[model samples]
Target: MSRKTLIPIGPYHPLQEEPELFKLYCDGEIVTDIKWETGYNHRGIEKLSESKSYDQVFFLVERICGICSTSHPFAFANAVEEIVAVEITDRAKYIRSIIGELERIHSHLLWVGLAGHFLGYNTVFMWAWKYREPVLDLFEMITGNRNSYAMFKVGGVRRDIENSKIPAIRKEIAVIRKKIDLLTGAVMDDPVIHARTKGVGILTRQDIIDYGAVGPTARASGVDIDVRRDDPYAAYPLVNWKVITAQAGDVFAKAEVRLLEMYESASIIEQCIDALEKMKEGDITLKINEIPEGLGTGRAEAPRGEVFHFVVSDGSNSPARHKIRAPSYTNIATFKKSCIGQTIADATLSLAAVDPCYCCTERMAAAYDNSSGKKILNANELIALSLKRTSELRKSGTGHE
Candidate 1:
C-alpha cells in the first residue's frame, strides 16, 4: 500500500494572491484527501462598519476586495437604501448600473488573465490584462480611482457620468468589444486549453447546490441563478441582457461563462450609456438624512458570485449590526468536491476554477475572549482544534472525507 504524502499549497503561495493554507494528502500523484485553513486575512470589516457612519461605510467596504471594490459599495448602498426607502432618479440608476457592469467586465478580464498565468499561458494573460486596462480607464474617466471607486452611496452614486464623456466612453467600449471577441475566440478554440481544462475540476449542479456556491461557479454547473436577474436591482432590469451559463461545470465551463458574460456586461453598459445620454445629469443622489430602525438585506451579482450585505439600523448614522458575505465563502468550499479525485498537478487549477478571492472570503471565526476583549486562541491553537474536530467527525462516520 502506498502511503499518502502531505503537500501544502498555501498560507502564502505564488499561485494564490492572498494568504490561505490548503493541506493536500496524496498517494504519489493522486490527491486522496484535503483540508484548508482561512482567517489569515481577517480585517474585521463588519465590526469596522459599526464604527463608521452611513456615508463613510461605502468607502470602508469598497476596500473589501480590490477587484470587486464597486460590488461591496453597490450591495451596501442597496441595503441602506432599503432602510431609507427612497427612490433615486432614472439617471442615477443608469450610472450605478454602468459602474457595476463595467466592474464586472474588469473583474472577469482580471480573472482570465490570472487563470492564464496559472496555466502558464502568458500570452493569454498579457492579452486579457491589456484589454482590462480600457475598462479601468473607463472607471478612471468616471471616478478618480482605478481600483477603489467611491461612487455608490445610500440612494445613488457620488459622481455623474456626464453627457460630454459619452462619445469617448462609447469609442472605448467599441474597441474593448473587438478585443474581447479576439480573446474569447483565442481561448475557446485553443486545443491546448481544451486538453488542459475541459474535464478538469468539475463541480456538478448538485455539488453547487450542496456547497451553496454562487456566481460563475454555480452558473457554470448549469445552475442558472443570478442575483441581478432574480432580485432585479439597479438598471439590470431596465437594460436588455441575459444571464450566462454553461453545462459542463469544469474549469473550461467557468472560463466560458465569464468570457460570454463580458459580452452581456458590455451590452448592458452600452444600453446604460445610451440611457445616460437621453437623461439629464446632476440628479445622482437623493437626500437621505437618517435611517430609521430596521433591518435590510441587499445582494448584488458580483463578478465572482453574490455579494450580500445585511444592515441593522438603530435609528442612528451608523449600523447597529452589519454583516457581509462574499461569494467565495461558499464557492471555495466546493474545492473539496472538485479536487479530491484529481491529480496534484490539477489541484491548483481546481482551486482557481472558482476564481477564489481569499481577501473577500475572510471572516472572523470567533477567536475573541468576550470578558477580556482579547483573542483567546492563536493560529496554531485554532488549527489544532479544527483538526481535532475533523478527526472526531470522520471517526464517527459523519464526515465526507
Candidate 2:
C-alpha cells in the first residue's frame, strides 16, 4: 500500500508568496492531494490605503510587495484615473510603460534565478542575479529607489526619462538581452531541464479558465490573455510587441514563456525610449486635488501576473474603500490541479513554475514520510532528488527505471 504522507512547505517561509503554508498529501513517491494555508504576512495595505489621500496612496501600495512594487502602484494609479476620467500626458504614458517593463525584467530575473536555485542550479542563480543589477541601477537612476519605485501616480508618472540617457540605457538593454538569450538557451534547450520540468505539473487550458489564472501561469497553458494587449494601457498600444505562450503547460513551458517575455519587455522599453527621445522632457504628472464619487477598477500586467486595484471614492481625498488583488491570489489556486499526480520530487518545481508573489516570494519545502512519521527532505534536497530522478530517467532511456 502507498502510505499517505503530508509534506508541509511553510507557514512563515517563502516559496511563491510572502508567507504561506502548504500541506501536500503524498502516497510514497507520488503526491496524491494538496491543501494550502496562507495569510501569514498581511500588512493590511488595502485598509491603510483608505486613510491616505489619493496622492499618498501611491507610496502605500508600492509596499504591498517589494518585487511587485511598481505593479501595485501602477494598478492603483489606473483605478484612480478611471474614477476621475483623467487622461495623462503622452510623455507620462511612455514613462510609465518604460518603468513597468523595467520592473518586469528585474522581477522575472529574480524568479528565474530563484527557480534555478530550487533545481540545484547555482550558476543560474549567480548569473541571473548578476544581470539583474543593471535593471535595478536603471530604476535607481530614474525613480530614486530600486525596489519601491514610487514613479507611478494617479495622473501620470512621477519622473521623466532623460533624453541623454536613452543611448546608454539602450546599450545596457542590448547587452542584457544577449545574456538573457544565452541563459534562456541554457535552460530551454537543455535536455536535463526538459527531463525535469517537461510533462510535469501539467495545467490544461480549461484549468486556467476555471481558476482564473493570469500572466505566465496562464500563458504557459496556451491561454491568450494579457492586460497590456487585451486591455491596452500606458504605451502598450503605441509599441509593437507579441505575447509569448506555450502549449505544454509544464514547468519548462512556464520558464520558456517568462524567458521569451523578457525579450519582449526589453523591446517594449526600447520602443518607449524611442518615443521619449522624440518628445520634449515635459510634465511628468498632472496633479489632482480631489476624487469624485465613483468606483474605479484598474489592472496592470504585473511580473508574476495581473495586479488589479479597485477604489471607491465619495468625493473625498481619501478612498472610501480600497481593494487590491494580486495575481498570486488566483495563481495559487491552480496549484491544486498542477501539484496532484506529480511525484514528491517534482512538487517543489511545480509550485515554482507558477511563480507566486504576494503568494510566492521565497522557496520553502518539507517532505514527510507518513508511514514512518519521518520528515524526509528539505527544499534543496527535494531538488537533488528531482535531479537524481532526471539522471535515472535519462540514463535508463525509460521512465520506469
lDDT per model vs. reference: 0.90, 0.85
1-401 in candidate 1: lDDT tens per residue? Answer: 89989999989888777899999999999998999888899876886688679988998899888989988998988898888887778888898899888999999999999889888899999999999999889889999889888988888888988899999999999999999999999999999899989999999999999999999999999999999999989988898999999999999999999999999999999999998898877988888777999999989989999999999999988999999999999998998899998998788888888999988989667577779999888767765876787689879998644
Q: Model 2: per-residue lDDT, tens digit, 91-156? A: 999999998999899989988998888787878889899989989888888888878888877788
Off by over 4 Å in 2: 13-17, 359-401
Which candidate tops TM-score?
1
In model 1, which range of ten residues has the least summed lDDT? 378-387
- Provide the global lDDT of candidate 1 against the true structure: 0.90
- Candidate 1 TM-score versus the reference: 0.91
Which residue pairs clash within candidate 1? 215-305
lDDT at 42, model 2: 51
- Candidate 2 has an lDDT of 0.85
C-alpha RMSD in Å of predicted model 1 compared with the true structure: 9.0
